[model samples]
Target: MDDLVRIHDILQHATPESLVILNEIFTSTTLADAIDLGGKILGRITAMGLVCVCVTFVDELASLNQATVSMVSTVDENDPAKRTFKVIRKPADGLAYAMVLARKYRLTHDQLKERIIP
Candidate 1:
């Protein structure tokens, strides 16, 4: 994890013309660990204003920097379990788990209307 942070520092001090490409830096790691590591690296890259492409599963990284734009691998709308393998530019709201639960349990607003009492 420190290596990830160190790379950020190196990139920060490097010439402005330098380009960095980090692929799947968070792979084979637990969710929490990946988030922690990704966050550190992203923080530095954003601060340095360096050009980078960091592929990661931590969706929160996308929103960490204004210069960072999210490109997500989307699932099928009809079947949330199916992956389309098509990456598209979109903001990660970090609500995918909630969405999946809602879909699985029919917990959408319309579905919950009758169960919810005002």
Candidate 2:
């Protein structure tokens, strides 16, 4: 059985706890598998009224419930390559895609202006 499945089984049978911390439980799974497992685990956690801190790349998890809050690591506006290492609680707005594209294609404001004017 997969490690995530085993962990889920364990969590299901364990006594109700106050806090649960899960770190990247979906790391080794495909997108579909990750969503399935994540949803199940989150559902169980919510049913038990347990406080959970789940680290995930799946942004959909943030909207799963009112109790679920999201915080994202941010980068500096002045330096796209520099990570501020600060986590701010907010809804996911798909801004990370813009940042990735900017870095990958050198699409920063200054770079764009230089290319367009020449």
Candidate 3:
């Protein structure tokens, strides 16, 4: 499809000095196919030592921990209406964003339990 063609075009002329930026690629395909194909393309780019900034909802891709890969996400501490994006040099925590934020605000289940018991 168009997505594939666009990606192919980008890859065809990509070089190590390239700074590729992609957003939700292969969305026209199934989730699994998108992840698989996208991962392969990204892997190829990574192998070429290209600097890429890809925005995707696929956790598999976001969790990529290669030496050439650095993951960053927008974080809104406890407010959902605003985007207080903090630039982090690592992957997001394994816990859900809400849960992590709750912990930050001392609002986690464990924190509540301690308050109730003590």
Q: What are the candidates' C-alpha RMSDs?
A: 9.0, 6.5, 8.6
Better of 2 and 3 by lDDT: 2
Off by over 4 Å in 1: 1-13, 74-86, 93-118
- lDDT string for model 3 (1-118, tens) is 8888898899899887889999989878898998798888888888888888987767677765463455666556565434466656776454346765687678988999999998
Lowest-scoring 10 consecutive residues by lDDT in candidate 1?
92-101
CA lDDT for candidate 1? 0.73
How far in Å is the alpha carbon of 29 misplaced in model 2? Answer: 1.7
Write candidate 2's Cα lDDT for 14-86 as tens digits: 6665578888787787888887878888888888888888877787776788778888878888775667889
Between prediction 1 and prediction 2, the one with superior lDDT is 2
Error of 2 at 14 (Å): 4.7
Ranking, lDDT, top scorer first: 2, 3, 1
Stretches off by above 4 angstroms in model 2 are: 9-17, 95-118
Q: What is the descending TM-score order?
A: 2, 3, 1
RMSD of model 3, in Å? 8.6
For candidate 1, lDDT tens digit of each residue in 19-53?
87777776667888777877877777777777887
How many steric overlaps are in each model, in order? 0, 0, 0
What is the lDDT, from 0 to 100, of the residue 112 in candidate 2?
91
Candidate 2 to truth, TM? 0.69
Candidate 3 segments exceeding 4 Å error = 68-70, 93-118
TM-score to true structure, per model: 0.56, 0.69, 0.67
